[model samples]
Target: MSDAAVTADLETYLSERVRSTPPSGIRRFFEIAATMDDVISLGIGEPDFVTPQPAVQAGIDALNDGQTSYTANAGRADLRTAISEELSSRYGVSYDAEDEILSTVGVSEAMQLTMLSVLDPGDEILIPEPCFVSYAPTARFAEANVVHVPTSVENNFQVTAETLESYITPNTKALFLGYPNNPTGAVLRRDTLEDIAALVQEHDLLVISDEIYDRLVYGEAHERGHVCVPSIDGLRERTILLGGFSKGYAMTGWRIGYACAPAPILRGLYKVHQYMIMSAPTVSQIAAHTAITECQDEVETMRQAYDERRRVLVDGLNEAGLPTFEPEGAFYCFPDIRSTGLTSEEFVQQLLEEEHVACVPGDAFGPSGAGYVRCSYATGLDDVKEAVRRIQRFAAKHQNG
Candidate 1:
């Protein structure tokens, strides 16, 4: 057969879900930015900081000590215990280290495990929109129906219990939450979380709460601190909490994260994890264990820097006529570009082409993001300042005709 026939045959064998889902909308912009010179990127969610010294040293020590092998499927027992203690101390929530926690490659794998473990084909998961790009697709990959429940800047990009209840159907099995949200940088408040917990109880729904950016919260949001979902009343038994060292401890390359739930639920995730991943990287697990135990000062230092960058970017975008809401968590600013008479994609494309500043279009996250663009403050302070200048120049050129 000819190459075209072979290609068509392979395509025919592909799963319908795999073929239908497009590549991440965020990747296209990153690809274009890669070919350009002197581009300032505020597109990716990754931190610019290096992994903390203690964690780095820990990984090196493990290697030097010749400790390189697959860990127990749930990851190193000590790491799990450290995580349990960390959560208990930080959020007033406790877990059985041996049974309630399962470490995976990263939060990405943890998310996939949760979706597969909890969702049956045709089951519906209600996800708030303008969320992380992966949440909906991961559920779809699990053969679950993804129901988007849109939230707007008017509501501060937070999904309410009332809004969620309206979307519920008989087949709805879970609610997927990514707060200290990607793209929008929105964090759910304690009161809102309480309301959501009550709703979840009434509906008898499970919740997958992705709190990867939990430690990166800022200002008033930080004052209240990050609320671990299971810590909320009525939620402990029903919520699967996904967290990682990527954002909080600058360990993206280490690829270490975990999922914690009630043991019965976690066992289902563990079964999937053991078959799919077996275990997280042993060295990375060691690094993360050190990070959890010996890196609080380092985490705080990086967070302070991100908060500073966040302030500069938010202020700069608003001054640039972009009308950005002040994000209280994570390191992103979603700025409205409608005033410049540009669609989110058009603004992002033109800005990249003309100003050499890279940002993801808001709609790439969800339709609710159509009039805005997500600019990450995870880049350097200098780059953020320069990107702000370029954006201002671009905005002035296109402002309301």
Candidate 2:
């Protein structure tokens, strides 16, 4: 009953993976910021906008009508049909509503389900570095070997097929993509995606494409639009597309998202989802259907606001002496902080303490993120402008350090 013995026994009870994996690098800074005054946080990724009124009303009405019970394991048929139609209209991809789509708690669960359904122990999943923090860990939780393929700001943090091919091994079974990517805010171009699709075909690998930010591409990026992975030739059968209402629709709390794939692959995800999550919240599904059917104007309004903030933040960071690549999508800008002679961890910690501006250390995403920091532009414009001012002051002090 000694303290050391008790500790040892506790350690023995948890799996090594759970014990060894570190906590999210994104959360600690936020927790610290919460305890401070006058802090401007460009840290978290949730949208600042309220959920569109129609969707909110839908949820309220559904709840008032006592529609709180679970839907079918694959989610409400109407939601699934709407999702199928939305994808078809937006991307020219068709999914059978009855069998090729499943609504889950969020893209997070869809990701977990995809990993569990398609990956086996010792299988390797190639994930580009500077990715969303959850990508590698979720695969690890599913007992897959995560190969972090490094991308750089030199190429706007994009992963090319040639680069991905170099990382492939016999054990490599899938590619996990999070385009309009987190931390870096990078989107894969059509040619690049085509190349990746070809590579996937050559390798005969499954793909888990997390496009939760699919609707958030901006300006010229929007002109090109998001290249829905399954919409690409030869990829539909092999790709699992994950999307949700959280980012673009401002429904993060609703916990509704979906996975689409060929029916057989989707059925696999459906099985895992049914057992792991009985169904997405029924009211959320109802609300999300309203989001899809009634909220296009609101979604566009939010996109325009984010686009405006994106320009200001990126330009400000560059002018502040932190070289930032213009993000084409999503709500983050990753700035190179190497000019300050500090590691990403050092820069963010010092910036937090000295300036009361909180953002995530880039290396939290992967090793390739070491010289950078992630600043989310999902907050108010004035807050972003003020954060830039604080960052400028901090950068000036340490520019030659």
lDDT of 1 at 98: 93
Off by over 4 Å in 2: 2-8
lDDT of each: 0.93, 0.93
Candidate 1, number of clashes: 0
Using TM-score, give the best candidate's number.
1
Indicate the TM-score of model 1: 0.99
User: Over the stretch 1-401, how does candidate 2's per-residue lDDT look in tens digits?
Assistant: 99999998888889988987899999999999999999999999999999999999999999999998879999999999999999999999999999899999998899989988998999999999899988988899989999999999887899999899999999999998889899898998988889999999999999889999999998788998898988888899888899999999999999999999988888888888878999999999999999999999999999999999999999999998999988888899999999999999999899999999999999999999999999999999999999999999999999967
Model 1: pairs clashing at backbone N, Cα or C within 3 Å: none
Off by over 4 Å in 1: none
Report the number of backbone clashes for model 2: 0
Clash pairs for candidate 2: none
Q: Residue by residue across 237-352, what tens digits does model 1's lDDT show?
A: 99999999999999999999999999999999999998898999999999999999999999999999999999999999999888998798888999999998889899999999
Task: Give the lowest summed-lDDT range of ten residues in model 2.
Answer: 266-275
